[model samples]
Target: MSILLVEDEAPKRKNIRSLLEQMDLLGLVSEACSVGSAIRSLRSSSFDLILLDMSLPTFDIVAGESGGRAQGFGGVEVLRYMDRFKLPTAVIVVTAYPAFSQGDKEIDLTELGKNLEAQHPKIFRGIVFYNSMFSTWRDELKTKIEEVIIR
Candidate 1:
């Protein structure tokens, strides 16, 4: 199966790739370091799964842009694009912040998840935190990926 990995930080991406390799789920992996590149990758190829980082740089290096500021909702933009196009690829959202931890009442992940699901059901396979104080994220990620494979 094909997988698209979208992450901005080099070290984090490397770590995730290592984890996937350990899980024996690292097949045909492709990387996108920014929102623009992720979207372009989506347009160019079909993937069975996408490991998406919520925060990413604004510009796409593959498109000749060197660097750009981080876009806070870069992953959301990619999701919206997939939902708009009705892409069949399953997405697993990875983030450092807790989904409901945002103080903003209207902008928190709870609201975002609800709104997105209302529009495009079954688009998200899971939302996993890369770091958590009370949960084992790595274990959860492995479980979720296994479930995806079964599906």
Candidate 2:
């Protein structure tokens, strides 16, 4: 499967990429560190799944400066960009947002799952994959790929 992983953290990004490599599933995994880069990559190629981060720091340079905005947001903007720009790609919110109140030293994947379901019910093909801090990328992902490809 062609997987596009969009993340901004070094550790989490490396961990997930390593996991994919270990699982022999990094064949078509494209890495993007921000929403803009991911959007550009999406415009150039097609991917089967998009592993998105819920918190992204996007920028818009207007002049010689190399900065725009450093907001603590992610997937919501990415989705909004996709819809506004008419980019056709499936996304999976693999975030650690609902895992806590945004970095409070606590975790709650269950609540995250419920919120994902409620907000993304129409996106049935999307997977609310666990946060980057939460390890374990199983061969079950391969199974899911098979099911999706077959359909």
Candidate 3:
């Protein structure tokens, strides 16, 4: 039961991987850098939980940070993409999208959870937030991943 980690930053990815290993979860941590890689990973293997980075470099992170993309995507784009799957793999969109309250049409965490649970059932576990500057989220993700793995 691997925990798929889809993040682009080397430092953050390393730090998160370290924490997961510390929790006796090294074998359960898999990494990916982009949407294509992530999708491929999902297709080729099975993961208990997906620790995603909502701010993918796909839409030009530079442009997204500077406010340019039409979709205003960061991590939520992953969620929107998940919704399209007829046999969608279970997913959790780990992101830092701003102004994405529960009411917004955009891909919010609460909505994403509901969608995954409702649409994908057991395969779609849940989500965990990512904090680039801190390892707290990494530890928290380890706990969440453990729950799914143990189940």
Candidate 4:
């Protein structure tokens, strides 16, 4: 199955890739580090699954330049784009943050997941909180992937 991984942090991306490799499910895996790059990939290719991070830079980071402003709900934007285009790809948010700002208030991951599912039910599969210190996220991700595969 084709998979698109959208994450800005190098270490996290590496870890996720390693996990996918371990699962032996790394078929046609594409990586994108920013909102723009992720969107471009979505436009050009079709993916069975997308492992997304909640926050991302506006564009890909250059060697000497900082990537543009970071979007707190970047994964949401990507989901919206997929919904707009009626893409059949499913998304599982792999976020490091437990909560993020939404306007003036903070929204927890659970609430964000519910909102996303409500807004884009067709493509929003679920959310997986990632913490490098714990192995739970790895198991959770594996379960989610297995579910997708069975579907």
**Which candidate achieves the best TM-score against the true structure?**
4
Q: Where's the lowest-lDDT run of ten residues in candidate 4?
A: 19-28
Winner by TM-score between candidate 4 and candidate 1: 4
Question: What TM-scores do the predictions have?
Answer: 0.82, 0.66, 0.63, 0.97
TM-score of 1: 0.82
For all candidates, the clash counts are 0, 2, 3, 0
What TM-score does model 4 achieve against the real structure?
Answer: 0.97
Best-to-worst order by lDDT is 4, 1, 2, 3
Order candidates by TM-score, high to low: 4, 1, 2, 3
lDDT of each: 0.79, 0.64, 0.63, 0.91
Query: Number of clashing pairs, model 3?
Result: 3
Candidate 1 per-residue lDDT, tens place, 1-151, comes to 8889999887678878888898776777999988888999999999999989887887765457665876777888898899888898888877776553245653555566566567657678777778634447778777888888899
Tell me the spans in candidate 3 whose CA falls farther than 4 Å from its real position. Answer: 59-90, 98-108, 115-120, 133-135
Could you list the CA RMSD of all candidates, in the order they appear? Answer: 3.3, 4.9, 4.9, 0.9
Flag the better candidate by TM-score, 2 or 3: 2
Q: Could you say which candidate leads in lDDT?
A: 4
- After aligning candidate 1 to the native by TM-score, how far in Å is the CA of 86 from where it should be? 1.5
lDDT of 3 by residue, 5-105 (tens): 88877777787778777878778678777665666776787666677775665533343363233333344555555555543444555555433534445
| RMSD score of candidate 1 (Å) | 3.3
